[model samples]
Target: MKFNNKIVIVTGGARGIGASIVQHFINAGAIVHILDREFPDSFDVGGNDSVFRASGDVTNSDDVKSFIKGVVTKSGRIDSLVNNAGIIRDNMIWKMDESDFDAVIDVNLKGPWLMCKEIAPIMREQNNGRIVNIASRSWLGSAGQSNYSSSKGGIVSLTRVLALELGKNNITVNAVAPGLIDTPMTRSLPPEVFKKLENTIPTKKAGHPEDIAHAVAFLASDESKFINGQVIHVDGGKSIGANLH
Candidate 1:
C-alpha cells in the first residue's frame, strides 16, 4: 500500500477531502502534485518537499495541458491521477441558473475528461497507471442537486469508459462515491439540516474525509489492478437504501 516515490496527481487538493487524499499519498511516501485554485494560509504543507502545488483552473484546457507537461518534464512519469476537483451548484432544475449548471458540469465532469485526455497517453506509453475519480452518491439521486448529480453521473460513465479503453495498458479507472462526509462544505449546512441529513444515513453519523481518502488510496493501489470500471460507495450503507423514513 505504500507508494514509495511514486508520482501522484490530485486535483482540488488544497483543502477538504482532496487535501486529505493528498496527505494520505504523501504519508505513504508518494510525491504528490496538487492542483488547486488557492492554498489559504490555514492549509499548510509544513515545508514538505514531496508536495507540488499548482494553482490553476481544472476547466481550462491550456492550464491542464501546461500542468501535465510540467509534471511530465520534471518527473518523467505519472503513476496515478485522482480527479477530485469538483464544484457544487445545487438547486432544483427550475430554480437553477444556466451558468451554475454549466459551471458545475465544467468543473465536475469536463475537468476530469480534460485531465484524462492529457494523461491517458502518458500512462499508455509507460504501460502503467491508476485513475481514481471522486464521484458522489448523489449521482443516484438528490432532490436539490440536479447539476451536481448529472455531473457525477457523467463521472461514473467516464470511469467505466476509460477502464475499458485503458485496461490493456495496465491502467485501471475506478470511482469513489462519498456520502455524508464531514467537510467544510458540509459544515456550511445549517445545524438542523446537517443533523437531518446525518440521521438519514444508516450509520446515523457523518463520515470523515479520511474515510473517503482511504478508499481512494485503496483504489489507486496496485492490488486493485484487476478491479476496474467500478464505483465503490464509501457512504455508510446509504447507497443500499438508507432513508429518512
Candidate 2:
C-alpha cells in the first residue's frame, strides 16, 4: 500500500491504537496528521517528516472544524480520514452516571459525526476520499458498556449512511471493528480480568494495534475502492461467536 504524498488525518492519535495507525501510515509514505488532547512522553513521532501533530478536542465541533481547516490550508487536501478518537466510560445501565453516558457518546459518536460532516464536503468537492471509522466489536453488545456499545453501534450505522451519501462522489466509507486489542487502556485492566478476557477470545490471545492499523491501511488504500459501507472485524475470530467451550 503505497500512499506516497497522501494526506491522512487520524484523530486521537497521540497514543495507543491511534498512534499505531499514525506510524503505519507514515511508514506507507502518507503525510500523517494527528489530533489528540495530549501526547504521551514516550510518543516517538520523530524520524518521519510525514508526521504532523496537533492538540484538539474531537468532541468540540469548533475544535474539530478548525483542525480540519488548518490541515487543508497546510496540506491542500485530505485523501483519507481515520476517526479513531473515542472514549470509554463503562458502567452497568442501572449504575451508570448521566455524565459518563454523555461523555462517551459525545466523544465516540458525535465526534466522528462532526468530522464526517466537515470533511465530507471537501472530499465531495475533490471527488475522491476514503474514511475508516474505528468502531469496536463491543458494538455487538457488552455488559456494563451500554453507553459505549450504543456509541459504536451508531458509528457502524453512520459509516453505512456516509457510504451511501458519498458514493456518487467517489468516496469509500468503512469501519474496522477491533476486539480486545492490547493498548494502554486494556493494559490497565486487572491481570485476572485481562486473562479471562483473553481466554474468551477464540485465539486465546489479544490483538496488537498494528493488526488494526493494517486493516485501516487497506480500507484507506485505493485498492479497496469497491469495498464500501462494510465493517471488517480485526478481532481474531472473536466476533464469530463466544467460545462456548
- lDDT per residue (tens digit) for residues 1-245 in model 1: 79999999999999999999999999999998988888888987656889999999999999999999989987889999999988887778999999999999999999999999999999999999999999999999999999999999999999999999999999999999999899878888889989999998999998999999999999999988899999999989899984766
| Clash totals in order | 0, 0
Report the lDDT of model 1 for residue 240.
Answer: 93
Query: Using Cα atoms with residue i matched to residue i, what is each candidate's TM-score against the true structure?
Result: 0.98, 0.98
Candidate 2's C-alpha runs over 4 A off are none
lDDT of each: 0.93, 0.94
Encode model 2's per-residue lDDT on 1-245: one tens digit a residue: 99999999999998889999999999888999898989877889765678888899999989998999999988999999999988888879999999999999999999999999999999999999999999999999999899999999999999999999999999999999999999988888888988898999999999999999999999999899999999999997988987976
